[model samples]
Target: MAIDILSHRDPKVATDILKIQQESYAVEAELINFSDIPPFRDSVQSIVENDETFIGYMIEEKIVGVLAYKEEQEEIDIYRMMVDPAYFRRGIGESLLKHLFATMPNKPVVVQTGKGNEPAVNLYLKYGFEPVDEVEVEPDVWIVMMKKAQ
Candidate 1:
């Protein structure tokens, strides 16, 4: 499996990305009003046209994962990231993270995850991301913010 990170907005890779989304976030994805669990969106033309802020991981020419971030003057704020379940536990997430650490300047990288999602929190911690704050989004849904830096 080859790893290729590309602009999150790449059009050629949307379909595969969409498939991964549909399979990964089914119900939780719908809570966000999404018909599917896309890291971003399939028709968000920006996913392919916007290059100022977005990144994705490709395998054998297909986009099996994605990482979207906003580059700020101080740190990179991650918007979303998801790996096709079939590709989980394979270090692809870590690779994308490593890529961010390698390319980000000097500010901490920020990310958010479902409050109860231990796996995500663990992944962040494994990469040195620590909890910074927590906020309630819905009456029952809380989000934990984590940050990491070089």
Candidate 2:
């Protein structure tokens, strides 16, 4: 397995990331009981046009996980962290996250996930991300924002 920066502007790369994103977010949707999560509405064109930097986890040269983030003046805002459902329990998400921290050290990092998604919440907490806020994105659907201070 390897972690590498992904060029979202490339059609093939954007398509691959979109596939993993859709599949991964589908599981999160089911877990959170919310079908309208924004990532589900994203397209390859939208990904290609996004400002966030993308990093991919590859196994035998095929992308199976992805992490996208934006670098702010004082912190890093993580927009997406996803792994193909078929590749769950294989530590792909953890690997991608660790790669981000290792490459961009000394910066505070922030992320948001479905409040009810235990796996995601636990993973963030395990990495020292503390829940900072919770917002009701829709009726009874809460999104938890977490942060790891530098």
Candidate 3:
């Protein structure tokens, strides 16, 4: 499905992000269980700021996925990532990840997901990310951290 991942930012991208999160994440997952997640009513404006830290993926000219990261002093930390439910499992997420890796020029990348998020863990592992640690952020809720060396 001819997809394009761009490094541009606009208001609609944030709106799309909220929709994607609502669609992709299960209610009980730690990814959503945390108060960190924005409610549907909140706009994605802050998240879509055209900072060097942001990247977005478009399919057929429509925003379908996005990831946000920061190039830190020692490593690249992926703070946010999501794919449109309608477009999940179509390699869009994978392509965006590969694009991020290529764009980062072989830096160490780190990501975190909920322990119950098997799909996310599997996807990260498939792309050479290894589980490095786990932290309990809430009662019975844990964050599984992984890293991939470029």
Candidate 4:
């Protein structure tokens, strides 16, 4: 298993990232009972044009997980955390989060996930992220925003 930076400019890389993203977000959509999560609408072209930095977790050269984030002067905003369902329960997401914390230390970290997604919320809470807000995005759907202080 290896984790490395992924260039969105590479078509093949962008395609792989998009595939993992769709598959992963599909699970989140089901958990939240909402299918309109923004990542589902992404294409390879859109991923290639995105401004976030992507890091991929690989096994034998195949990307099995991806984490995308943007670093700013005050904080690091985590945009996406995806692990292929076929590769779930293997610590891929935790590994990617650890990599981010290691590489971008001393910055507040922020992320949002489905309010009903227990696994994701637990993971963030386990790592010291506290729930800061909960926004209802749809009639019955909500998103929870979490933050970890610097």
Candidate 4: Cα lDDT at 141: 95
Q: Write the per-residue lDDT of candidate 1 for residues 48-91, one digit (tens) a residue.
A: 56544545677667776677688888878987777888878888
| Candidate 1 vs. true structure, TM-score | 0.78
As a whole number from 0 to 100, the lDDT of residue 17 in candidate 4 is 94
What does candidate 3's lDDT look like per residue over 16-132, in tens digits? Answer: 666765665544244436544433334566555635465667766677777777888888998767777777778877877888887776689999888777778888999999999
Cα shift from native, residue 34, model 2 (Å)? 0.6
Which TM-score value belongs to model 2? Answer: 0.98
The local lDDT score (0 to 100) that residue 33 gets in candidate 2 is: 97
Candidate 2 lDDT, 62-120, residue by residue in tens: 99999999999999999999999999999888898899899995999999999999999
Residue range 41-134, candidate 4, lDDT tens digits: 8999999999999999999999999999999888999999999999998899899999999998699999999998888999999889999999
Q: What's model 1's lDDT at 50?
A: 52
What is candidate 2's local distance difference test score?
0.94
RMSD of each: 3.4, 0.7, 3.1, 0.7
The local distance difference test score of each candidate is 0.69, 0.94, 0.71, 0.94
TM-score of each: 0.78, 0.98, 0.80, 0.98
> Lowest summed-lDDT stretch of 10 residues in model 3?
34-43
Error of 1 at 14 (Å): 2.6
